[model samples]
Target: MKSGIFCLSLDTELMWGRPDLPIWRQRAATVRPNIQKLLKLFTKYNFPATWAIVGQLFLPGDPLWHGPDIIKAIRKTPRQEIGCHTFNHLDFGRCPIQEADEDLKKWLQATQKQEIKPGSFAFPFNHVGHLKLLAKHGFKAYRGPAGHWFAPLGKAGEIIDSLAQITPPAGKPKQANHGLFNFSESQFYVSAWGLRKYIPLSSRVGKAKKGIRRAIAEKRLFHLWFHPINLSDQTGPLLAGLEEIIKFAKQQPGLEINNMEEMTRQLN
Candidate 1:
């Protein structure tokens, strides 16, 4: 690698991102504001962020829900990279392979109507499976779950994950898995809500900075990911923490920041 790479991606699925959780639907009010804040940050930094959206979010809505606006903003943003998160946010690891394949195909066809040929895919809930299906569908890369102790535990993993925002252990980068590029997450931005809210902002920043520093010195890929909803409750603190990390990154020698798709292209 020419320099350490920092990859940032957002699972921008809205209600579909967490269909089972009522909190996702209840927190609907904060979506737009959170998006706007992130957009401003992107503009300020010329940052490229991968938005792995649930395919349903592209459908026309009745104004009460976000659909058209989501599509418009994503399509219009020059620095945003769009990726498929699945049509219904189906869990590929739990659902039948055939069912997941069909969902992927439908998502591909639907998004193509909007002229978005996604080069990347992120499994809904980070439940990775059907890589052959992804490769056949023409996805060049996919984001795996953040590497942590609970990451591989399936359903129980989700609960334990909220308790831990640990960064992945440092190692050599494996550019691809099965057939698609593996741009797995290294750190998850813990939400400033529920139990996680207890984690001091300094601690979150410290962990993220450690990841970035390790990436620069070790010359490895450091990936960070989170949902916009995670910022709904404490947008200011979370964004400020993110800004601190970004500022730290700017000072690092030869470090490059890239969206998931951009990182995949660079690897190839």
Candidate 2:
């Protein structure tokens, strides 16, 4: 039987994650520490993860936004893959091809200075586009959009799924154009902030457990992703919930935890 894969990907964008939302700026201080806590948790579990960081976070300048120190910390962490989240967090689906190309070029230049050559990419806002450019820049894989039928329904569908405690869909990786492997996400791992706070932690953990079971039974990949800032407000409880899910996944036989880069190499 094929080994079931439990893949964790974090969109490690601090202020760059939602520049349009002024509230995220106010919560900036919490992001770095939350990420640090997450790293510790990953260490404790002996699990690897893919951290898709925004390009601007690598450059030196703003203390609130830029975080070369945090970048270094992630690099030093064992089995953690640092993937690109694009420069300026461009919405590739909406942005013009020329603009997307420029953004990717800047991302390559910035990551190069940090001595980081990322083989995996995560589209900003999960808005996928510009595959040829990604291949041109030597990216081997990217986290694609959610494959569920309700994905087109947006946040409403997400809320309903969370409320219903539905088992998220998992699938095998598919080769996209330009030889890039597309790892479709299973779930977003609902944040404990905003209106999402009403979503019981049990629901989140339970859903993840179910997804893991599905993956193991079907020999598919369960790719769970979330932004670090999502845990800023309810840090302890959220982290604990995540730990529960991780522990559950770790206990399962034949379930292999993998970072995005590792998955790409395996699929290749």
Candidate 3:
């Protein structure tokens, strides 16, 4: 049961310059349109997705709060799963553990009104400092960069051929790229995407096509993840490429598109 998961990260840009950030914070200008675009693409292609909503969106006093609207947006797409990025997209490895836990608590609280109970968590910057805390807190799974889902590999893009090549960081489990459960294709950690301006549509489609083809033949998982903000200024071509890839995906029988949470459950 291989799955092609599209996770649209909804990180609100509440940058350091709080005073100047609001100019970019116009919900109608930023979050709303990108999200709407995602819904349209997902619906147009009949793909299921996971939305990792920022937790601060539910903060009561913030005037630009999009908690209600974000939820409404997710409802527009079928098989959309809700997950948490953080109260803000603060890197958890540098953030105080207490603060991180508080954000998770606040995120859970924000979801009390919704039908979804998020079982998966994605770290901002793909940094993790406390898996014990997350597990102790009842989080079912933590999805870090496949770059080193089996951590201590000298950041992503570093070459460590297989699990045997690198020593596990003290106690972290060794990863198996060429293994029985998953294939090396899904094991690739994204080095960077959205690199060039109006990049050719074939470039992106090729990645999806390659992943999908390999998944069909090898029975592997084609996991593609990206931030919505990556498309902030140059979303036109990205969306078009995504629409094409997704449309192509739905046409393939047994080519399922599901959320990370669903994949986690099935894999585990």
Candidate 4:
């Protein structure tokens, strides 16, 4: 078995990721700087990351949006794997599978025009359920909801998985019924952001360190995920904590650090 795997995925949906939340509109302008910060961090660690971008972000000009420029920068960023986060950030669990499938296809066509055929898909809000459609539409892996941190609270597992930083068991990564790999996310870098600044940087860093240690011991994947918007404010401390985890991962022997596509290929 590999020593461990370190996978970082960024859900790069500006306002579309959380359209229901009116507050997100205020943070829409912060998206570019936040993305730049993440890219800088990736460069510092010589790390590769999967950027699951909303297809609409590729379009030019919309309510203080710099879509084309951001897309160009992401494409230029080294070791960055561009992935799709649906055309309109559709919540697969809430919307009919047929509707979601249509959105997924449109996303592919849009990104394909930009020469990006993403091998990985991360459902908007992590409301994932349409696994068969993902495979049929040609995604190698989809980031699944992590196992329950607390009791299985219905669909709460999906939300908690996106917010909570938890360690996973030592086992092979599971594959979805449709034959796509389920790279279940293990942690959220920024637990809470902006007005709801509940989770401190120290706490997040501590949890990340523990997760890293656990992955090393268990020989499992330490998958960390988050949205760029979360880092729009208080970025210094958050990036510092992330750097701590990345630095620690570098010291381990035979540890496999991979993006979503690479991880899927290796596991398959």
Candidate 5:
């Protein structure tokens, strides 16, 4: 077992980041601060992070959508890589496999302008139908559940996640099932909000850090992920808490935090 790759999906939506389930307006303003804070800290630490930039967030001629400063921020950030989440953040699980292929291909075309063809993908809602389509569509990896997601088949690129989220509002908004996706081994999924919820997941950052540290020490890869917007919002502990996490990650010996492309290169 080794320290796994940390993959971040920077999506602009009302799905998970804004746990309040904020509508469109709030969703836009919410993620800004978290992303800003994340960028500053990542740059300071010289951590190369991968941003699964939501293609819809960069729509041409749309001021609200294109955050040039954010793009610049990512470019200025060291060791950062970019990937796609789809043009409109379309739901692949809802569409035919081939239809989803076309949608994802369109995303590839848009992202190709920046020389990114998405070696990996974080499905819009992690609602997967047919994963084989990913390998068919030129995606070398699919950042999804290791196995239980499909039952009977789970492999690489199908990363594992264990969210373990606590302190809920009222209902389990489809995204709130933070428990591990019923998988054994090192395969588990965690989300952006998990960054904050880790307070509930572990006794203290040190204990949690030890687990993450141990995974790395054992040479087992442990991926910690979340959306940039999830970190950007003005909501909770994101802004201030980010520095602490980065500083902690840097202090751990043998633990190297890398962007997605680097992770794929190292693992795949």
Candidate 6:
């Protein structure tokens, strides 16, 4: 059997993702530092990650919103793939097709300035749509919605799954419209903020380990994703738990870690 693929993707959006939220505004300062820490952790574990950055953040000016420097850092890092999280963080599900197309065009325009033609896309809020536009723009793969049956139930289901420590489902990538692959998410590394702080770190690590084992057994993909800002609250424990998950994954036989780009190539 082929080895299982372990893919980690970070939605590297800062305030762009939650500009309407007061808490996000308050926590804005911590995003950069937490991202730096995450980069170091990935380096320590020799793990490659896909960073799906918000395209608007790549524009010039506005230190609080723009992040050209962060983009440069990810590009300079070895084995890291820089992907797109849409321009303006537009929700494709609710937006008109033309609007979605415009956003993708804008995202391509922004990233092209940096000589980056992103092949992997992560939908804003994981609300997927407009695959034809993505493939038209040359995106080969996208991080799709979670595969869990309980996912559609939204927040309550998510909290229940986290508290129950359910083994996250691992599955094979499915080909979508216009030559794109849907790399469905296996688990979200829940953030230690608000009511989520009550969930123990052990549950997160254990669930990831379980997902890895399931992937190896099923010969499927285990794609884990999280926003960088999620780590800003209680950063220490979250980072430590992430490191533990990475270390555990490293020790597992028949499991190969990859960024989204690598996985897409293998699929092709």
Top TM-score model: 6
- The weakest ten consecutive residues by lDDT in model 1 span 158-167
Q: Candidate 1 or 2, higher lDDT? A: 2
Q: Estimate each model's TM-score.
A: 0.90, 0.96, 0.71, 0.88, 0.68, 0.96
Measured by TM-score, how close is model 4 to the native structure? 0.88
Ten-residue region with minimum lDDT total, candidate 3: 166-175
Query: lDDT scores for all predictions?
Result: 0.77, 0.87, 0.55, 0.76, 0.50, 0.87
159-238, model 1: which lDDT tens digit per residue? 45433544454434565666677876787777777766767787777777878887888888788888887898778999
What is the C-alpha lDDT profile of model 3 across 89-137, one tens digit per residue?
Answer: 6578887888778877777777766755756666776676566666655
How many residue pairs clash (N, CA or C atoms closer than 3 angstroms) in each of the candidate models, in the order given?
0, 0, 0, 0, 26, 0
Would you list the clashing residue pairs of candidate 6?
Answer: none
**RMSD for each model, in Å, please?**
2.9, 1.4, 7.3, 3.2, 8.9, 1.3
Question: What does the lDDT read for residue 214 in candidate 5?
Answer: 52
Which wins on lDDT, candidate 1 or candidate 5? Answer: 1
Badly placed stretches (over 4 Å) of model 5 are: 1-9, 12-22, 61-69, 146-210, 232-236
lDDT, candidate 6, 69-93, per-residue tens: 8887777778899998998999987
Q: Residue-wise lDDT of candidate 4 within 91-200, one digit each (tens)? A: 88799888987898888877778787759988887888777888888888878777545536643553443346555433347775788887777776753564336556
1-268 per-residue lDDT for model 2 (tens digits)? 2788999999977788777788988677798888899889998988899999889888898877899998888888899999989888889989999998899889889988767885988998898898998998889999988667667887777777988889898878878689998888998888877678888889989899999999999998999999888887788999999999999998999898999899887776
Q: What ranking emerges by lDDT with the best candidate at the front?
A: 2, 6, 1, 4, 3, 5
Tens-digit lDDT string for candidate 5 (64-96): 455545665676677776665655666777887
User: Any idea how many clashes model 6 has?
Assistant: 0
| CA error at residue 143 for candidate 3, angstroms | 2.3
Error of 3 at 43 (Å): 2.1
